[model samples]
Target: MSAPTGKALEEVRAKAQADVRALRKRVDHLDNDAIDLILRQARSHYAWTDKPVTDEIIHELYEITAGGPTSMNTCPARFVFVRSQEGKERLAKSLKPANVPKVMGAPVSVIIAHDLNFWTELPFLFPHEDRRPHFEGKAEHAEVTAFRNGTLQGGYFMIAARALGLDVGPISGFSNEIADAEFFAGTSLKSNFLCNIGYADETALFQKLPRFAFDQVCSFA
Candidate 1:
């Protein structure tokens, strides 16, 4: 694809600028239904319908999630989508009893992981400068950054799925060691968490739980 130029570039920039202005106004915001679909009405779905989540949808989900920002664009998040029966069985071995059925029943279980040596790609991802050397000997700092950003990316994945009309049940009830051995063996990647993705069974949800109010959770410097 040729790079957009002239009128196309101007149109793109103009649309982006208009979007920013609209966001600043906060008046032409997402409709209530859209907000609900992405956040409010969304739930951590444990039970799923029989509808299969296709590869195309998974690809689209990754495309959307990949757009989320990361520090120095490290983007260490790695996903292993377990959709086959054998994959589910392997994942089940790592899950707690209560979470096994959830994983097995969902259309797909995503193993969200991060590469411990993510900084090795800093030269490519953040190529404007030589940044890879900074993390070469800093194992502790690199691991921390990878895990933190990987977890954040997983959150973005869940939101992206929700935005695409899919339900997600993210859980930490699985054995990371087992997951790593089964799915990421001989690799630098380490499992962060598991997320079941599919259409939800509304009847399977429990009453919504309460959340801390904004006033109770925020403070000014």
Candidate 2:
């Protein structure tokens, strides 16, 4: 495949710009209830109920999450859903002892990883320009871009899961080396984080923790 020419790119951009207006006309913004459902009232679950996260739901969540923007649309995230007992057993070996039980109880645990060869897809994803040169064969550069954008996609994945009515528990309490060896052997992928997904057991929740106020963490530009 080839990159779009200047005129072709302009036309595509114009159509997308027009689409923004059309989309806003249908739903200008999400309401407070929607916001609360997706973010504010959402909790990171520690215990999960028996309800399973189905394949259809996983696909549905991905369809929405993949729409999230990444740097030059590199979209490097690679997800592995561990639902079987055998898969869970392998995954648990890499998780910290403290996180193992909760993760094991989850109906599904996803390994979010990034591909070092992500830029190879730039010709297809970011066809307006040949962006591959920025990362191709540049190991250090590719790794940074992959991890950064892949992590952004990970956040989108959690938000999408919440929006789809599944509770999420994201954790970095695991050994990356072990996880990579177990799941990504002989591959360019590197594990970023793990997220447990299922119907949460609300009773297991801890007291809400305080977050930094705007003034405490923000500053004027």
Candidate 3:
């Protein structure tokens, strides 16, 4: 779509600012159904229907995910949407036997990865200070930061996909080495996880699993 300009851009920004102000005044939480759509009711779908996810939806998903916060705004996450049959085949050798079918059947499998040298872009993303020097020779620190923030972005990606009415199945049962060779070769990027996105086949869904109570998982300091 064409970029919104002049009065249109101003109106869009105004509406967004108004929404933020309105939310700050709200005390009530989201309704149960709305909550379920993004969290409680969303399932890790293993089976997919014949429906195809369009490129437009994928772009919209990124648009939403890109808004999520990252450490020092270092946004290290890089995505490879493996949609073609050839791409799936290339990925198959890296996946565990069990995850192979789920990935192959899905319309799209996303390779969620991080750039090892994400700090190099800090000048553009976090220009207030010279942050690149902090991580220039700190290889260990850079790797940890990249993995932590990139993994967080992956979570954002799933939430964004669900909000867009798509199901998500994130799996880590794969060889990182092989995946790096197949997808990130000749690059500083490294694989973190894989997520399959598509419409879920309800008939194949398992019963919702239970979760720990709030008290069981949290305590005041």
Candidate 4:
């Protein structure tokens, strides 16, 4: 009910600093350049070996990702891991030609989805007050809010995965309609993106790409 106390704040600060220190070693250095490289290299990977991704590892990633903020703490994002032959086949059929092969070849692909009826469950997630009534008559607003927040959560998932020494290949070139029907059938969750998770082959990457300077993208005024 109340804001964080002084001790709570100190504890949070200590934990965050400790996390940064640990991540520094895991990420090769806790610098902006290292972060940029992590983001840049976490692109769509096409070639994969026959290694398997364990559910325990995925659960670990999920636990880390649960810390990402969402609007009203609604946390509307949902993920469906497609590991079975039938599930992968269904997911593969929905990818674009350029993405299909990579998705099919990856050890595991996760479908990041947003639930249309997520607000209805907010009573449990946002327990301070019943926020479901606020969204009851605002279908359009709810959809946009859920999509935007869930997308943010998905980005955090990728960053957390990278921090955990896993390579990510997130793609949007999949058929929403088909994927929804095939993989998300009987569910209110709608496909937002697909990401292949595994180790990266350093030899498989092409030349590095250029990026805009900070001045070009940001302004002090």
In terms of TM-score, the best-performing candidate is 2
**Candidate 4 Cα outliers beyond 4 Å, as residue runs:** 1-37, 40-44
lDDT of each: 0.92, 0.92, 0.94, 0.83
TM-score of each: 0.88, 0.95, 0.89, 0.82
Better TM-score candidate (1, 2)? 2
Of candidate 2, the 10-residue stretch with the lowest lDDT total is 1-10
Model 3: weakest 10-residue lDDT segment is 1-10
lDDT of 3: 0.94
lDDT top scorer? 3
Q: What is the lDDT of candidate 1?
A: 0.92
RMSD of each: 4.0, 1.5, 4.9, 4.5
Give each model's clash number.
0, 0, 0, 0
Ordered list by lDDT, greatest first? 3, 2, 1, 4
